[model samples]
Target: MHQNNLSDLHRFIDRPTSTWSGRNDGAGAAHRRVHQAVTSLGQGAPDSADAVFIGFASDEGVRRNGGRQGAADGPAALRSALGQLALAQGRNSLRHTDLALLDAGDVVVSSDLEEGQKKLAAAVRASVDAGVLPVVLGGGHEVAFGTYTGVADSRTRKTAGSATSQQPGRLGILNLDAHFDVRRAEQPTSGTPFYQALTRERAADTSCRYTVLGISEANNTQELFDTAHELGADYVVDEDCGVLNQQALLSTVREFVASVDIIYLTLDLDVLPASIAPGVSAPAGYGVPLEIINVVLKEVAASGKLAAFDVAELNPSFDSDGRTAQTAARLIHTVLTYYTPLSSAAPSLR
Candidate 1:
């Protein structure tokens, strides 16, 4: 464990992407954006930053489930796309100069998938202890369980002030996905993360409040729905989150936000329509709009209970012109820009 902890997490870097800035690179130019702006985490890495990005480079879980692979590279692709996103301006009409960013590289997921998740959990706890928001980039939805483990462990320690902290903070998990991902697998996979989380919380005697948005009736089986119902999971189907039923979705989401102390947000790109996000493994036939997605995310961030976040299931293998990566990046950008810590002095800047 010590040796693994000492190693920097990245598994591969195809090449160092350029951070060159152009004379015409205005305040909004993406080429002069995130990649260069986010410092690398290392020996001299800044301990205090607005957010730390942790990547999980593994598709083993997806492969195990016989789903389309390539999500393993989701993090790198996200960085590349995010690098091109304009650094948003603040209320003062100038770029927000207080936001500090760090790239903690990718946590290598080995052939032993469970081992990798343990490492991921450790890394997450370490980051939280250091006091920065950890934005995990996923190799698969399986990353959810690992991320939840990290946050749960950190929150416990935070409240309890010990490794087994019984400090009483509860968690509200918000998943923007098409399927429930509650399949009971002896071996965990992209389809089993939420189920794994539910099991973990039950074993820990901790509260686990869960809600799902954008569920597709045709995609999930009756058994899965039964499992969700039995677990007391709150969910809104794909059609309900669409243009027609916006009011109901908002009402449920508002109530959801008001209920939890801490929020764990996970977004699976497949929840968006194929036309807007065609790069995922399972593209949506009739999905939610980017506008609606952004609205929900921004609202959650505004609630100030968003503790940890992860974006998953981005299969660049099937991407069309990098649309999916861009979409995911946009959501990420929105979170970074909109989230204000319950107690923070200023916006994060490098």
Candidate 2:
């Protein structure tokens, strides 16, 4: 049965249970893995789940942006990598929780990128309403727009006992990318989602903030930098985001987290060194180190304000020995291990 009336999420194709199968070392929690903890979204409503995984299967935006394709296969490859990982030990282990691991499956995007984004938005909204964190797997950085809309719309819904408090709270978008994707375009593309988001927020006068870390000065044009500056967005160049300055970066992340009521974290894999993450449309020539990225993820997860998250630009066609997908999975695992809900109070469910 459908989770709700959010039909825009056309034909939820449940990924096979075999996709989640992996090493089983015994009956002990110490021997458990991700595949053991996760369950299909169809098993039950995600109302009681801690996190719900949703896949956006499309690379139409990349094509429009004049980049190599194949990121459309990112979701499945990511799942395969994640399924094989060992769970963290001690108190941080997912095996300790009673909550289910829900995979709601892919929102297929054919020729129409906009329509596909709408379907993704619907799926995300449904997951948010059920009080579950939406862990989105992307087809491209274009996934950012769809993910943002869902989280933004969810904040507007009239929840129980908050009819008078329908005012949407501040949203902070923290982008980990090599490029400041705020390009001017006649149509939406991988390089224009942030631009689109900024425009929408400005027109509504919402208190949303967009910040990009790990921006490669060599990759983005002067126009993009000027646009980001003119729009009042904060960003740090890749040179300034080295592992040696991790504390400073973490401080920056913490400050951003404090400023907003919630956070939406989007990672374009191209932000990492091409050697570390080579399976993206535009692999980084001198990207931020993975160690720095790991620390940032820890800070964000511990903040308890992270409402939604997505990893973008994982093009399997260019991946080397599946390294990119594995790295993405590792990052996801780190987030899952450290995430803390906003408060002890029960989340306001729709």
Candidate 3:
């Protein structure tokens, strides 16, 4: 039944490998890492997996906006970076043996970018159907719409009262972005995802509960802020989101997580400082540091409300020595590892 929904994802995936050289045994277990762990989401019936990854490999939305236009390659760059890390980073134990990650491959996007988003939504819906969380590797921030579509559609299928459950409460959207991305565009672009979401939610009579962190006041026009305000959206500027403000940021995240039944976390690469994540469509000259950003992300992940996740705008074409890809991968790693179920024996459904 899902064969029509998923096109070429299992066939069109990039399998990147990581090289390891060491004692090869008891001492240096270099062979045990992410690359070795991730398997194909076989015919949409993955035998076992904690999270399923789907790549959105189209940059047509970015191209339409005339921004740095190589984010089409972001998915593979993210995979390459993610495949290289140790299964368990030092100072932390990933309990790698307890995790099963599946790489579901990329959505086959053609000239029609909107169609690609639809395909992505289908792929994500399929993953959720299989009792696995979807960690989407995005071509651009435009992927947010598709990601949201999948999560929203799957809400009813979700088990009630669980974090990913579909209960009588609002769905919270938390975007870690430097710009509001709430543009009133005649056509959808990497710059108009959130606005598109808000529009859809309003039309569907879904209560809107959105909060954007790391907003750069100068990067976003006053009109965008006004639109966000009019929509009853909340925000925190870049200056107020640094590592020095950890207490404030965590409190904010905890409060927001408590108010929503489920969370769809979108991490736009541009929200990080240009010095740290320079391979996005637009680099932030003054953005949040990775350490501080991870703190809030970790809190949300462990909160059990995280339903789905998408990392966007990782343009390998603009990266220097793959620093940005690595940063994005690190965030992915943190979220996955930080998520420890309240009762491991009872795997939470997403």
As a whole number from 0 to 100, the lDDT of residue 164 in candidate 3 is 61
The local lDDT score (0 to 100) that residue 106 gets in candidate 1 is: 73
Q: Pick the candidate with the highest lDDT.
A: 2
Tens-place lDDT per residue, model 3, 49-94, is 6777888887888887778988888988898888776665455443
Model 1: colliding residue pairs: 9-106, 98-348, 98-349, 99-348, 99-349, 100-348, 100-349
Against the true structure, candidate 3 reaches a TM-score of: 0.86
Residue pairs clashing in model 3 are none
TM-score of each: 0.86, 0.89, 0.86
User: Quick one: best TM-score, which candidate?
Assistant: 2
Model 2 clashing residue pairs (backbone): none
For candidate 1, the per-residue lDDT at 295 reads 73
lDDT string, candidate 1, 48-76, tens digits: 57777888888888888888888888887
**Residue 53 in model 2: shift from native, Å?**
0.7
By lDDT, rank the candidates, best first: 2, 3, 1
Global lDDT for candidate 1? Answer: 0.75
RMSD of model 1 against the true structure: 5.2
Off by over 4 Å in 3: 1-31, 43-46, 89-97, 156-168, 340-350
Better of 1 and 3 by lDDT: 3
For model 1, the superposed segments whose C-alpha errors exceed 4 Å read: 1-32, 90-97, 156-167, 342-350
